[model samples]
Target: MGGFEDREKAFEAKYARDEEVAFRVTARRNRLLGQWAAAQMKLTPEETEAYAKSVVQADFEEAGDEDVVRKLVGDLTAAGIAIDESTVRVAIEEMAAEARRQFMEAK
Candidate 1:
């Protein structure tokens, strides 16, 4: 009985760790996506960093990535970047994958 209880506790701990990692990865991915957009928009280095932080903050506007996507699409369009929502969505996916890979490697 003790062994079973220990296993359950271990599983719960692992789940919590995974959730934290996932949140960190999503933030990193958003930052990277923002940097990419900033580059495309010809933002200066200082502006790029600030823009990335704004992108990270945009995630808080909702429960999921839709808010981030919407923010990116609107900002990019306003900056004359000529990007569509689908392209931003694809970039978000790609950045997420890259973020996960980088996080795993760091672990």
Candidate 2:
């Protein structure tokens, strides 16, 4: 019983850590995606930083990535940048990879 309890606690701890890492990676990806979009829209440096933060916040609007995608697509279109959902999706994938790489390098 003690061995089983210890194993369960260890698993729980690993799960918590993994969840934290995933959240951080997603936030980093969102920030990178925002920077990319800001560059596409030719935003100023200050504006770009703010936009990246906003993008990170956008993730909290829902459980999945749709909220972020919708925001980016709508904002980019409103800014007169020709972009589509698929393009943004690709950017998200690329940013996710970059974010993961960054975390790995930091490790």
Candidate 3:
């Protein structure tokens, strides 16, 4: 019983840590994606930073990546950039990998 409880506790801790890491990775990916979009739109340096932060905040609007995708697609199109959902999806994957790599490097 004691060992069982210990295992359960450890599992919970690991779950929490994993969730935190995933959230961080997602946020980082969003920031990178935002910067990429901003670059495509030829935004100023300060505008790029603000846009990146806005993208990160956009993620909190809903679960999954739809919110971010919608925001990016809408904003990019509005800026006269030719982008589509598929391209944004690919960027998300790329940014996610980069984000994970950054985290791993940090550790």
lDDT of each: 0.94, 0.98, 0.96
- Error of model 2, residue 65, in angstroms: 0.4
Where model 2 places Cα greater than 4 Å from the true spot, the runs are: none
lDDT (tens digit, per residue) of candidate 1 on 1-107:
99999999999999999899989999999999989999999999999999999999999989988999899999989987888999999999999999999998998
- Choose the strongest candidate by TM-score: 2
Tens digits of per-residue lDDT, candidate 3, 22-68, equal 99999999999999999999999999999999999999999999999
- TM-score of every prediction relative to native: 0.94, 0.99, 0.98
Clashing pairs in 3: none
Better-scoring candidate (lDDT), 1 or 3: 3
Task: Summarize candidate 2's per-residue lDDT along 1-107 as a digit string, tens digits.
Answer: 99999999999999999999999999999999999999999999999999999999999999999999999999999999889999999999999999999988988
